[model samples]
Target: MDTKTFGQTRLLKACAACSVVAALLGCAAPAAQYYPDEEQAIEDEVGAALPPGSAIVEFTTNSAAVAAFQQRVGDKLCEPDAQHIAARVRRREIPSEVQQNFRGLANFLSLGALAQIEKLPKTKIAHYPANQPIAFAATAYITDGTCGPLFLQFTPQAAKRYSLSMDFNGQSCRLGIREMDESTQTRPVKHSRWRCAEGFLGIGKPTLIGPDEIN
Candidate 1:
């Protein structure tokens, strides 16, 4: 390659790098209000532990990609504006207002050591209603994008510890739910495949829904 050609190649690479950095540092997404303040978080956390309440679910997503866990609001199945257990962006990537608003059960994530994480340094946790069967719509996203949301459901027992996980290997992803036994043992919970009466992959967004939800 001639010197001029080599210089042009370098310029192109530089522009691409700039675009990525701009997206990373400046393009953080909007987040929902999980906990309003410390006092409310405490009350909610305590209430969740009692019978006919929520169960503690520790989340450990071991993947370079970031994913979201959205619980159905009341009976609004597969609604776009569901409650976010974890926003699609990592906690490290969350904007300042979210940092101040969430605590206790909602204060489970605090990782910002890397501009882009290889994997979260440790597990992040969450609390969800356990009085009845619950389900979440999950979607994974990477530097490029990801396959669309799929459904995950389990009947969480009160006072029991639960841990959920997701793994994304570039081409595909996997989600798992387990009923944790006294914080020591984990047993997998199997259910019939999820049924969503409707589906939509946000166009031009980070998710591109496949023909089916399993990805």
Candidate 2:
């Protein structure tokens, strides 16, 4: 073969080898790692556990409604009952069947269905502010009216323990690095607190508490 043709052939061979090497390298490299911070990782875990693209809703409220809600649901481990009531009130119109079920369940002495809800990995709560809007985690269904501020309770399925520092209605809900129970109940930690902005709730999904968080 002519010298010029031989050189061209060698160049083509070299280019082909380079292409093969590039393809192999690309395949070997890991996919994009999120490399999220502690809180972000927790949130990502929670988001993954939730239904695809779950919708979060916020409600408006007033003092009277808040007071009534507080009165109806006290701090006696009645998270389930409180959620049921809040769901109905925030929506301003729950199905008769749902209301009947909740009230009927309430009448019974079965921890008022608190255990039932606690057992589940996922739960939602609504907070209603009279004359404002009701806070819903998923969607809104208001029949009577819409006016003030509300909060929703979201019990994560995979998060055993998590902390939250959220700003709702210009107020802060702060907690430290919380623990998750085997049943996936999230509660606050005493020390290890941090200032988080609004809409930041750390959920503890099945994640190896990284070395940084540990140390």
- lDDT by residue for model 2 (1-215), tens: 11000000001222333344234323233332321232121112233343332322212221111111212243222121353332212111122333345544442433333233222211222222322222122111111122212222332222233322221121211111234565867454322111112332545332221111111
TM-score of each: 0.52, 0.16
Please give me the total number of clashing residue pairs in predicted model 2: 28
Q: Report, for every candidate in turn, its global Cα lDDT versus the true structure.
A: 0.47, 0.25
> Number of the top candidate by TM-score?
1
Off by over 4 Å in 1: 1-19, 22-53, 85-122, 190-192, 195-215
Model 1, 1-215: lDDT tens digits are: 11000000001223344344435433354532222222121112333345356677665454435666677556445444457565333323223443334322122232332333423332555566766766666666654455445566566776777766655544666666666885478675543235343334534423322223322
**Taking the candidates one at a time, how many backbone clashes does each contain?**
0, 28
